[model samples]
Target: MLRRAPRECGSWWWDLDDVTETGLVPALGTAARMAAVLGKHALLEPSSLEWDWFERGRGGLGVHTRLGLMGSRLDDPELAEQARACRPVGHPAAEMSALLVTGPGERLDAEGEPRREPRLVELTVSPDPYGCWAEVAVHHDVWSPCDFGGEPHPAVHANNAPRLAAALRALDALLGVPGEPGEPTYFGVAEGHGLKAPELVDGLGPDLTDLL
Candidate 1:
């Protein structure tokens, strides 16, 4: 089952042309826990590997992929063991931009240094363009003022606005935490998977509209 922490990051993300229908995806079965909210309701439960999303640069975008707090939490033994068993998302990566990171939180070096800033992401999962879909906790920090080892995708600041708005909405719906409604990139977007916003009264910080 997919593991989720109630007190952990509250967030969401998705593709450029996708929408709620396409965004409502399956969780990786390997997820030991998960929390989801549809409409005005909330649901937290065990997840499956089938819910995972694949990371494929299609050999150009940028350094793409993710490592959660669960990754370094191996000292706990229980989570480390489970993280090692994570299953591949298996979805076709044929259309992914260079390196796109998904999920919440910020990037860290081996010594736990802030690798770079954060970003609000947007993507189109299919070969054919369409409406928006799905939401992710964090995404590729391409827009940050960091080096992508000299990659080929656009920087994070160049991200589309509509897509970011959609991602924020998705996260708010699932996490059930609204952001401080305001302009785009109010939080600077990137920082790994930053699901919980500090601007929120409940400590979740900001509403999805906060970024609009």
Candidate 2:
């Protein structure tokens, strides 16, 4: 199933489980599609993540590093090169285990130079066996002030809430299961206002792209 937490810093998470090997490919394909849907606003790039839950006890050791393929498709061969770059020569375990797609809100070139107006829209998706999930963060260094401490005002969520809701709805239809919200984290909130679930569509058409 798939579930989501509340929106914090315009970032939220969706979790899914019991994913089959056959189903994993399709799930990623849909993710690629949804990424494309939001591509015009931001550029999605592949990343490498190292998760060692036992390293820091409860805090744990988590490392997220952007890898390769600035604008390449999910199937691009350069992805392999990028993946190889993620792992050090003698440390295979350091290789990235999670498949991450991150879209920065700022308009920048492949060389990381600014080129356009800043939209403050960032999106990320990591599809892996651990727990498939996506995140959306908006605004600049400062995020909306909505937290458990108080109610979220409309102005606070004016920029990214609707877009996040739309993305969640799209993801729901693609996954074929309704997900539940998970525990809250500093990066993701467990409660949100004006959030809506995606309507169940009748048919699963040819929306799948980047099939493995």
| Residue-level lDDT tens digits of model 1 in 1-212 | 11122221223333433222321221121121112221111121111112223344444333233435433321234533443344334543533321222332223333433332323222112212334333333233232232122222223323422234444455554434443322234333433333222333432323323222
Error of 1 at 79 (Å): 23
Cα error, candidate 2, residue 158 (Å): 4.0
TM-score of 1: 0.21
Q: What total of clashing residue pairs does each candidate reach?
A: 65, 7
Cα distance off (Å), candidate 2, residue 16: 4.6
Q: Best by lDDT, which number?
A: 2
How far does residue 196 in candidate 2 sit from its true spot (Å)?
Answer: 12
lDDT of 2 by residue, 51-93 (tens): 2222212332354455544556654555545554654444444
The window of 10 residues in a row where model 1 has the poorest summed lDDT is 38-47
- TM per model? 0.21, 0.50
- Candidate 1: residue 16 Cα off by (Å): 26
